[model samples]
Target: MTSTVGVSGAGTQDYDVIVVGARCAGAPAALLLARLGHRVLLVDRATFPSDTISTHLIHPPGLAALERWGLLDRVVGTGCPAIDIYAFDLGPFVLAGSPAGEGFDVSYAPRRTVLDKILVDAAAESGAEVREGFTVEEILVDGGTVTGIRGHDKDGGTTIDRARIVVGADGLHSTVAKATAATSYAEKPKINAYYYTYWAGLPMYGQFEAFDRED
Candidate 1:
């Protein structure tokens, strides 16, 4: 069972690390940290089995990491097919090849709904306290140092949690990053847009296809 905390009438709780965002990056960090016997608090605004916009492809290196973490079998059990070949259509001709590496031969494209929940569950099983549906409203700063976080549960019950380290694993527009005025380097403007959708009865046949068009 996953361990959760309620903010109703709760006082300030302390932890060794507080991670915001419980998806791919945050969950695994929490899992490994908790496995090292540190008190970790992992919070995310959305609950598990939720969908997010993504390319949804896990390359071989990622699969190998999951294998090391002992979660690859569970992902395969979800019936997500393996992707071995990649084909690119460049208008006049096509380029096709399989991934070439020693231990990196295949990849998997699982839906975010399935992938995120598995990661969160693994973190929880590793003894990281997971708070789903919890929104972090503030990053507490004390004398130019981040000391804690102030957030609320889904029911609007507020709570304050302190930790030695605060991690901002929340995506592109991370609240923690904004709070800390983090700087960005080597960033580029968007040049293209992508549209993705799921088909009910489509099969990929262990291949990934990409098309190039001059715009």
Candidate 2:
């Protein structure tokens, strides 16, 4: 059975679902739940138009999902160009082709700042309560089952939200995963270091290029 808890005289506030990390995964899940008429609370530690370290590339299948969710137009409306060509250089060989799939013939590399905000907006518009800059400090658990989350808002105010279901969509180093002991393969170490920044007027915008560098 699902349980709920109240915080700070909020009059027993409760939701059907509570989602942490309002990015690609969390926002979409929350949007779906809200569209299904479930009360949802979507929280994120970052504000809109803020950057996150991401490759931001969405393949045809991902584009198809976005289209099904009615968000592809919004993504393209942000002026993010679509990439149809792919090139891979393996030093001794080269492979170039365009990916074709149902309802999508290309891929996209929208900026993270723009993409994430669009997802969050869609979740909000679908009736999910979204809280930006809300940091999840703890995952509430009982009898070995996840219940909800305790966190802080942007104003540094503490908040304890409860729901029937709690989803941790936080990225790789997820707090919920750690608190629930749900992680594996901890022995793997970082392999490479990557540094990237956006630049304007790059002619390679609509082209996907990959290089194999051994140095």
- lDDT, candidate 2, 77-127, per-residue tens: 988888988999989998999977877778989988889889999999999
Name model 1 segments beyond 4 Å from true: 1-13
- Looking at candidate 1, what is the lDDT of residue 204? 62
Please name the candidate that would achieve the greatest lDDT relative to the true structure: 1
The predictions' CA RMSDs to the true structure, in order, are 5.3, 4.8
Per-candidate TM equals: 0.91, 0.88
Clashes of 2: 0
| Candidate 1 structure lDDT | 0.85
Q: List runs of model 2 lying over 4 Å from the truth.
A: 1-13, 183-191
Query: Which lDDT tens digits does candidate 1 get at residues 93-207?
Result: 9999886553989888999999999999999999999999999999887777777899999999999988878888888778888887877766789998988888878866999
Q: In candidate 1, where is summed lDDT lowest over 10 consecutive residues?
A: 1-10
